[model samples]
Target: MAAGDIIPVHLYLCPLTLPGLSSDQQGRLLDTLPLDEQQKVMRYRMASAREKGLLVRCYLRALLSKAHTQLNQSSLNQSPLNQSQLNADIDGAIGPSEWRFDYLDKGKPVLSKAFFARSQLVFNLSHSGDYMLLAIAKSPRLELGVDIERLRQNTNIHAILNHYFTRQEREAMLALPSTRQRERFFDLWALKESYIKAKGLGLALSLKSFYFELSETECQALSFKGLDARQARLEQAARLFLVKEDSQQTDLGNDPQQAQPAAGWQSKLWQLDDEYRFALSLSSTDPLDLRCEMVSAQALLSE
Candidate 1:
């Protein structure tokens, strides 16, 4: 989106389906991508992983194509869609130069160039079990991250809680009834992962250093206890983002350059289906207008 556009957060979920997408169709999708991406997809040994990678990239391109078109339409004061032009733009497609991506030192990918100097567009992706999730925001000034996980019964829950959670967090989770404990574990893990992804530090930010305390009304971020000063500083700087309902209380006085904890960070936990949990973390100076959309593998790969 253009600079300062307040586009809704786009969350896409695609199931892993092998039908409909023929070998040639798959090849065509791969052909549209840069050679490096093609090589990476080709390198995946697992069939599901390879296909998931392919579909995720293509779906992202389609969404970007749509976003770019909308951005231009707004600038020209045009209607949301000029059907003919919109279809052509979606199908003909633009090259990747406009949206080339580069990763942070910690492996979080970011847009390398904005359509306008002030564009705030940012996005993040996560995949698990039967679905892959991609979160995109229209603003260039916002930090965005998303994570999805399918419930799994095989993991050692006690070990995970002990290893990754704070003593307080572990106790809190364990206090839940056994049936709900698993769900809570995944919920907390997704929250932490989403925050790390939003910060663009990935796992370089220690999981154990910070924790999210959940309640019916709000999720509180506990003071971080990192091993060193830098992690400690980051933890101290982390602020829970404000939602649309909480916007009136926000004070926009913090200096972005100071790396302070008051940086607006809004988070939400979602239940995609009975089997999956999703979490979103965004760093924006204002409240987040989050939205989610689900698509099947067929819809994503369709002509």
Candidate 2:
């Protein structure tokens, strides 16, 4: 696929936890980046890997299969490949079935502005301690970001608030009852994290600058800072979903008819069944009932 082509992700939850993952690029993506960038990527990667690494890998492989169908088999046959660089090279070709860019540093020696700016395609990989969330969308659909945290320990919600929450957000968070507020607080945090991740511009964009309509009930996007965050709005493209694997919510394996191909994620909020708190953003497209396809990370793997 050309860099400008439409490449949307279909998210998934890996069944493996962070500690459960142990192979290749299955659990550790941060190591590929520069040391400085590692911390930021580590900020999120460690969470997913620590919590949902295994499941994330399973789900990601499933998502890749979906993209694989769209690939021209003949073209794939003609491309030169090396088994050792299989994953990296194929990633260079088809991009991600589910990939992301937010924490990518522009000044880093390993990553370039052009690399993260592959404007047409974007996907997200997130995990806490037990569940990994994978989301895919067109660059035009929704600029999306996501963070998964294990529901462990004290969660230290209060301390983190001082670092990222704006005055208004902090007030809004505190105004609610403690129990309910904690849950809502996380949703809002995930929403903001997801927003930043999708922006791909990283910390240069202030967390408080863009105000997200994050409620337990809905997902909304608004730029409060009037910063350049506006361009991050992915226009026209839709966020569609297909199930390559099953989770807690729906069961597609029972219905063969459900496995039909989809036009795109036009407008629909379908659940894939992993319950570690998953949400999606669509740019704006019509909804269509399509079958979920599977793309192999191995498909991207060079022969």
Per-model TM values vs. the true structure: 0.73, 0.47
Per-residue lDDT over 1-303 for candidate 2, one digit per residue giving the tens place of the 0 to 100 score? 343344434444343422333356543443433454344444555644433323343345445444343432323466766675556545654333333323456321111235334434356666555445566544344455445544434678898876666554577678889875666566556556554555566677566454333324343332212111121121212222233333213322234343333233223222222223434543334331222232223322322
lDDT of each: 0.63, 0.43
**What pairs collide in candidate 1?**
119-140, 120-139, 120-140, 120-141, 121-139, 121-140, 237-261, 241-265, 241-266
Model 2 RMSD in Å is 15.8
The positional error of residue 9 in candidate 2, measured at the CA in angstroms, is 4.9
Candidate 2 has an lDDT of 0.43
Worst 10 residues of 1 by lDDT: 228-237
Q: What is the Å distance of residue 114 in model 1 from its true position?
A: 5.8
- lDDT by residue for model 1 over 1-303, one digit each (tens)? 343445466565556665657787788778877888889999999876788888887777666655555545454454566778666545544444335677789877776664324345567888887667788766656777888887899978887766666554577788989998898888887788898888887666666555566766433331212221111001112234222322213322223332223344566776655677778787654544444455555554464
For candidate 2, the 10 contiguous residues with the lowest summed lDDT are: 224-233
